[model samples]
Target: MLVIQIYADNPLRNFNYLIACPSSREALVVDPLDVTRCLAAAKQHGLKITKILNTHEHWDHIDGNEEMRRHTGARLYAHNGAMGVIDHVDVGLYAGDTIAVGQSIKLKVLDTPGHTRSHVCLLANSAVPGLFCGDTLFNAGAGNCHNGGNVDDLYDTFSQQLAKLPDNTKIYPGHDYILTNLKFTLDREPGNRAAEDMLNMLLDHDPHNAYITTMAEERRINSFFRLDSPVIIDKLKSEDPDFSAAPSPRDVFTALRARRNTW
Candidate 1:
């Protein structure tokens, strides 16, 4: 299995993915916001994109769907719940559905609804695990529930689902917000040496070169994964001293999400 992550030169800083089988060279594309870039990348890799998949119905994630499908004659795959919002979906994907790319790669869909009620993340159990999390999760921060999403559901998805991934699983989110998200980590947990070190590293050279991250590393850097940290709780307490006598992890997660909204 071969996975190529392409950074889209768009205002949203979207990242499109192309996962293919080395032997067959047939690929599956995820959230193609830039059709031309996706096509060019596929061409460079000698890959034929056989399927275009969207994590949800967000415009930026699906903007290139029609054009990509027309260009490659690729079938579109998306969550059935998002069918109402996204057009021309050839396959209605569901939780546990496995979509095969070429002969080796089989992406198993996981129902993750936080960024949107219909959002889904894909898992590729290759030599190294990869999760195409889209807007459901990010490098240092979890996605917001502003657009047709629920924070409680987001909490459940994080605690019940994403947290179970192996420490080595590499998260391939839809957008590049790690630098800013890491800053948010320091804002809440100012004493976090790991986040500080990562923030400084990202400040050097081209930050995109420091993009790849693993779950174990995220445990040290991502604030969302560190809801139990006393420093973060103290920061939140500084704002509302009586918020909770002893805040639960869920409470801390909720408060952090709220603060990030204004950050």
Candidate 2:
């Protein structure tokens, strides 16, 4: 699988992906907000985009869908639930559905609802696995439940589905929030040497190339992955006098999300 990740120069720092089969040059666009850039990328790579997929029904994610579809004549796709929210979906994807990109590449759709009820993540089952998680997951933080999302559902998505994926799976999140999220991790777990080191490294790293974190790397830097750490629990306790000392992982996750909303 060949991946061309384009960084949309908007206030949201959205990362649009153009994934193609190197052999066939048949491609698919993910959450394409910048239509011109996507078209230019396809032109540069000599790829034929056969499909356009939105991970959720957020306006920003689907803003350029109509134009892109008109430009490339690509079929539009989204979760079945997004039928009401997103327009002109040629295919409504389900949990186990595979989106075939050319002859060899197939992406398994995972029903990952938390960022929104319509959210779904696509797992490319290539030699080097890649998870194109829109707002469901981030570099060092998890999506908040303030906008049509549930904290419990987000936690379940992490523990039951995302956590089970191979540690080597490359995480391709929709936006660039690694820097702020890493600061949040340090704010919660000041003793995390791994997070600290990554923070220093990322100061020089381009945010455009920041979405290539593996599950193994996330385990060390992402606080959501380290919900059981004493330092994070202690920080929670210190901030909220009534915070539980022996908080469950889910409890820790809930508290962290709540705090991040205000932080």
Candidate 3:
């Protein structure tokens, strides 16, 4: 059995995931920001953490790496691009690299550079498949491209790479920004029933309770993934007259990202 545990960390509402194979009792922690909480959770489950996987070099994601490693003595894995940024990476991962944990849990690495040039996401091919998306992708929005990030790169990461994932793939983002992101989507496409319904459902629960979402649900509500939709396109055009010049999907995405940075 595959055990996936999620913990919401402090200071930034960050999420850290512990994925373990019960048969072998070997586990990997994804984007651990709070070492104390993570170690405690692992001890509670009686799982030995064998590896620390980073999705990016952001402080919130890798802050607890050294401490976690000190406690568990787990090897660190990060993208090759994060060499200088991340202090210690035992294994420099790339786009096609696969990480095998225990006997059956295998995670495929995807180079999803947008939040940062070296950002990568881990796709777990387990009984319950999931995508550990860092800041590159979110529940209803994509990451900002202000810090060493490119809009075009983010566009491709979402449209070409992440969009190809199975509809049932569960998304585990770095932060719990779902409620705010969905609110922004509603503002952009008020006529969208999917966004409205999702917003209402989220309102019923605490913001912290609605962090995880499926790709299928994201497709229905995430405006970033629906750049080509007529409603979204029209909304963009209305917001910015420059967008009316026969903008491509990429252009629409670019405009939306810029607007979201301030929104």
| Candidate No. with top lDDT | 2
Instruction: Encode model 3's per-residue lDDT on 140-245: one tens digit a residue.
Output: 8889988789999999999889989888899888887888898889877778798888778777655345447889988988988887788778878887776666
Quick one: ranking by TM-score, best first? 2, 1, 3
Residue 228 of model 1: what lDDT?
Answer: 90
Per-residue lDDT tens digits for candidate 1, residues 18-48, read 9999999999999999889889989999999
Alpha-carbon runs more than 4 Å astray in model 1 = 205-210
Whole-model Cα lDDT of every candidate shown, in order: 0.90, 0.91, 0.85
Greater TM-score among 2 and 3 belongs to: 2
Q: lDDT tens string, model 2, 1-263?
A: 99988999889999999989999999999999999999999999999999999999998899999999899899999999999889999999999999999888999999998888779999998899999999999998898787799999999999999988998999999999998999999999997998899889888777666548899989999999898898898888988988876889999999988889999
Better structure of 1 and 2 per lDDT: 2
Best TM-score among the predictions, by candidate number:
2
In terms of lDDT, model 2 sits at: 0.91
- Model 2, 7: alpha-carbon shift in Å? 0.3
lDDT-based ranking, best first? Answer: 2, 1, 3
